[model samples]
Target: MNHDAYPDNYIRGILNSVKSIAMVGASPVNVRPSYFAFKYLAQRGYDMIPVNPGHVGKDLLGKPFVASLRDIGRPLDMIDIFRNSSHIMPVVEEALTLDPLPKVIWMQLGARDDAAAAKAEAAGIKVVMNRCPKIEYGRLSSEISWMGVNSRTLSSKRPPAPTQGMRLSINRMSVGGGDTAASDRAAKNKSEQS
Candidate 1:
């Protein structure tokens, strides 16, 4: 899988539409990314089912944890995977075997298994690889609310500012509607007259 296959629109759609998510390999450890991501989404009004074999029967974020997708015993909109690529296939296989399969399979950053992804995609499951739902949600949902990025901001990182005049002009043109061509010509004429 070209890592770029995960589109922003797809991520946004999942983030908006899915009310309940089954988070595989979800950890209760505060330091883990999955723990924070799951908590963040839950706080955003998503019903998060924490799935980890070791954590079965444990409580996380006021919800009872299940060992696997099958143990959850209900329909799920999506599964946000925090597991490594090597451990993904079994989860994909199990997801397929669910009575009501999930709509999407999202693999977190640095996690991508082509064969597992193919299986999910072939089963009509929307596949997102090498992306974090938390980061994508922050971006597409406009939750960042800041231009500059830092430890304070949640975006992956911002690209450098445009260097060329044409790039700046195009950015302005894309946002505002006016007689831009005529305005440019008039501006050029005024500059020449000066």
Candidate 2:
């Protein structure tokens, strides 16, 4: 997968496959991006765990924080790193030692380490860099577009009425989704038209 660009399907697949996520560098403050992302994924029904050594005893959105990845005490589908780029490798190394390795190592927006990503990929793990799962989830589900954001997907209709209130699946609108260049073109066109 390209570190600079991601196809919608790649993101959708991760989001759909990941039932549990370990959010490294999660924050107690509600205003932080980590807090918001954790809350959003948790609300979306993903089993979200917060990993922050400084706040191990604290809770974020009802989930108690763990000091490190090993403390999770359960298998994880993904590890969403919110730490700075320089700190990614240590986290990835620690993740590699887990018994049932995580399926994905996702570096958050503005937080990417090419070497760490390569290491994870070498271990047959999927890697995502410089992206936010929260944003991707919203974009793929057309939830963000409801707020007038360009989701890079074209659709003439809305998804079926939710069985649950305001809940959306990653499969909402998949048009122009899998091709990175194509999706960029669509977004560019939509932006230019606006």
Candidate 3:
């Protein structure tokens, strides 16, 4: 898997197959990129578990934070790393220890460790480096165009509307304000509907 040029299908396949994500370096603060990414992925219907040692026992988008991936106590489909490039190796090492290891290791934008990615892939876990799942989901789903961001590949045909329970609301009120309570309620509503 070349991190430099990932084929669209390879990226889309991972996104479509993953169901649960453990976000390493997740933040309780709403303004951070990690917070936005976490909220975005959760809203898209992925079971998002926040992993942050400092915020352990605290809540993010209504889910309690765990100190580490090992504390999740359940199978995870992906590990979305929000930590620095220098920190990825240790996290990958920890991820490999899980009983039913995650199917993917995704390093967030600006976070990439070639050595760590190699280790994970050699162990049979798929790796996506220096990419953000939130952005990838939007781009693949053609939802970014709704925000006026050109996704480059255009089609005359409109993408199908997301199913009722899976509707995506990219309204500034829902995303930019950093309102956890509203975000949590929205996530809860989405889950119940699902």
Off by more than 4 A, model 1: 1-5, 145-147, 150-194
Task: Choose 1 or 2, whichever is better by TM-score.
Answer: 2
Candidate order (lDDT): 2, 3, 1
Query: In angstroms, what RMSD does candidate 1 have relative to the true structure?
Result: 15.0
Candidate 1 vs 3: which has more lDDT: 3
Best by TM-score: 2
Alpha-carbon local distance difference test for all models: 0.71, 0.85, 0.81
Clashing pairs in 2: none
Q: List model 2 lDDT by residue over 10-116, tens digit each.
A: 88888888899999999989899999999888888889899999997779878899999999999999999999989999999999999899999999987777788
| C-alpha TM-score for every candidate | 0.73, 0.86, 0.82
For lDDT, the strongest prediction is 2
- What does candidate 1's lDDT look like per residue over 1-194, in tens digits? 34444334455566767777999989999999999888877766678999988988788889888987988888999998999879899999999998778988888876777789899989898888777777666544444435432212123445446343211110110112322346445544553454
lDDT of 1 at 193: 59
Q: Which ten residues in a row are the worst by lDDT in model 1?
A: 166-175
Error of 2 at 137 (Å): 0.4
> lDDT per residue, candidate 3, 1-194, as tens digits?
76665766777778878899999999988899999999988888889999999998689989999998888999999999999888999999999999898899999987778889999999999999767899877876667868975443445555467774384433111222322346435544553454
